[model samples]
Target: MPLALDVLAQVPTRREAVREEYLRRVIPQFTGHSIGEVQWSTAHGDFHWANLAGPDLLVLDWEDWGTAPVGFDAATLYIYALQAPKTAARVRRSLAHILDDPAARVAELLVCAQVLQAADRTSFYATLAEPVRCHLQTLASRSA
Candidate 1:
């Protein structure tokens, strides 16, 4: 896990206690789940608007593609939604339409997922985001 931790350190700064507490609360939910197994391979890892095409989506940045936990992509999309409120609402609506989980639970899980993603700072905002820093503060407050 040192490699992953190293990757995390490269990203934005957040309160250490908050981040750790968040991880502690969420990690147990997925304990014993296979997280490192690759199930599908895609040509693009980060498929946001920057690389998307009209009507037809194109995957770019293949470097991050690998066998990862299920819903990993969805989590990434949710993070993107956080960065863009309209998109996030749309994503939430879509999830509500299909997912059986309660909205509050889903939201909590999404936060956890975002924290997990942040744990790997190989992306652009890894080193430059204040929101995530605030998130860390929130996590710390919750733990306290």
Candidate 2:
């Protein structure tokens, strides 16, 4: 899907699952105080394959729906796609503009940081840590 900027911009985010407090705390852990108000959007808060279905094409778990940082959905999808590199690459390719954006990159880094922070020591998140760390560093340097 193309960047949902115009549509998402019009929708005010009702923060809950990803509240401003969480973002303020998590984003700095990686970004080192580089905080600025990010572009918010109507996000599919939990945008994973399991939460999706075909034919009608629905996004599930309305409990978490709200305004999120512009690229949050794409970043979350990318994070979920990590086990399948090809799929992750496709996600990157499809949403390159959003993921490559400065504000969106911050959104991504925040997502990655939150993932790495809450990761279990001996689980799927553990496996994702290094790669996420690498990406976080790369994004941080690029932004600088």
lDDT of 2 by residue, 35-84 (tens): 78767777767777788787776767767877878788888888767767
lDDT of model number 1: 0.41
User: lDDT of all predictions, in order shown?
Assistant: 0.41, 0.73
Which residue pairs in candidate 2 collide? 13-67
Which window of ten consecutive residues has the lowest lDDT sum in model 2?
Answer: 1-10
> With candidate 2 superimposed using the best TM-score fit, by how many Å does residue 28's alpha carbon deviate from the native?
2.3
Candidate with top lDDT is 2
Model 1 residue 59 lDDT score: 45
**Where is model 1 poorest over a 10-residue stretch in terms of lDDT?**
32-41
Instruction: Give me the displacement of residue 49 in model 2, in angstroms.
Output: 2.1
Task: Report the Cα lDDT for residue 115, model 1.
Answer: 49
RMSD of 2: 2.8
Give candidate 2 regions above 4 Å deviation.
Answer: 1-17, 30-33
Task: Estimate the TM-score of every prediction.
Answer: 0.41, 0.80
